[model samples]
Target: MDNIDRKMLEILQEDSRITIIDLAKKLNLSRPSVNERFRRLQEKGIIEGFTARISHEKIGKGTLVIIQIGNLKVVCHKFEEIVKEEKAILECHRVTGSDSYFMKAVVSSTKELEELVDRLVPYGQLNTSVVLSSPVSNRTLLPEDEFLHKN
Candidate 1:
């Protein structure tokens, strides 16, 4: 992707609802050109999908927890199935180091967290932390800036 594509991604990351005309104005490109570039980016899989950022607190899921699972004896697929069955697990990553998996979960209360932990105990040893506050959350990548500026 070029500089224009990078700019487009940066802008879109901030607001995916931006119109083609507005995006064109920001990039100093014609509307059709901007639209075509966006289409190409989508086709190339650089732009995966657009989604809304919701407030978990507002939705009654105020508590945020990070869980690190170690010493997993269950099959990977079985573990994945269990993870998928959980409604509270928002994100799960197959991590390196001492941990086999890292999961981000949201719940209403401490009781809910305990129940979730109890369910996961049979699969592995869990280390959990309740998120106090997020200083920086959901950061978007700017690969072009890194690639272009390297000297």
Candidate 2:
């Protein structure tokens, strides 16, 4: 992808709901060209899909727990098959050291957390840490510091 494509991607990543006309204006390109580029990007699988970010607190799932999973081998192949049916697991990652995998789970109460841990035991050993509060969770993936970083 060229610089223009990357710029378009950056804009879209910030807010996917922006209109075609607005996007064209922002990128200083003709509407037809912008539309065509978007279509091509989609066709090439560069623009996979669009989705909304939902707040867990608003959805009545305020509790966040970081679960460290251990004693499991062959995670890449089997992990998906195992977790496909589970709904509470929001995110999972294979990690280094004593922890084989790190998982993010959303629960309503402490009892539910216990139950969730119980369910995960068959898959691997679980060490859960409840998030008391998050002062900041910077969800941005783009490099915002290149221009802003003073140092």
Candidate 3:
């Protein structure tokens, strides 16, 4: 993508609700041009679906936990079956390094967290950590992101 496309992505990542007119003004492009660019981005699969950031604590899911499941030969098809039924799990990824699977889950209380952990015991060696505070959580990516060059 070109600089203009990248800039539009950066803007959209910040606020997907921005009006076409406002976005055109920010990028110094015409409304029709900007709209076409956005349509192309979606058609090309460069832009995924937009989402709203929710406050988990306010919604009664106050506890956040990171779980690392190790000593697994594969992702284990049954793991997906079991995890899919759980709505508390926000994300689950098969990853490299010490952990075979990494998962993030949000729950209302410690009792709920324990129940979730118990159901996962048969999968692998599990290591779970409860998050107390987050200095940085979800930071949007841009063309000029420092993490992109750190490697």
**lDDT of model 2 at residue 44?**
75
Please report, in order, the local distance difference test score of every candidate based on alpha carbons. 0.93, 0.81, 0.87
Q: Which candidate number maximizes lDDT?
A: 1
TM-score, one value per model: 0.95, 0.79, 0.89
Better of 1 and 2 by lDDT: 1
Return the TM-score for candidate 1, rounded to 2 decimals.
0.95
> Taking the tens digit of each residue's C-alpha lDDT, what string does model 1 give over 1-151?
7888999999999999999889999999999999899999999898999999999999999999999999998987899999999999999999899999999999999999999999999999999999999999989777756774651
Q: Residue-wise lDDT of candidate 2 within 1-151, one digit each (tens)?
A: 5667767888998899999999999999999999998998899787889998788878888899998888865465686677656688898887899888888888888888888887778877779999898886745444345533531
lDDT of 1: 0.93
**Top TM-score model:** 1
Cα lDDT tens digits, model 3, 74-106, are 467878778789899999998889888899999
lDDT order, best first, reads 1, 3, 2
Q: Compare candidates 2 and 3 on lDDT and give the better one.
A: 3
List the candidates ranked by TM-score, beginning with the highest. 1, 3, 2
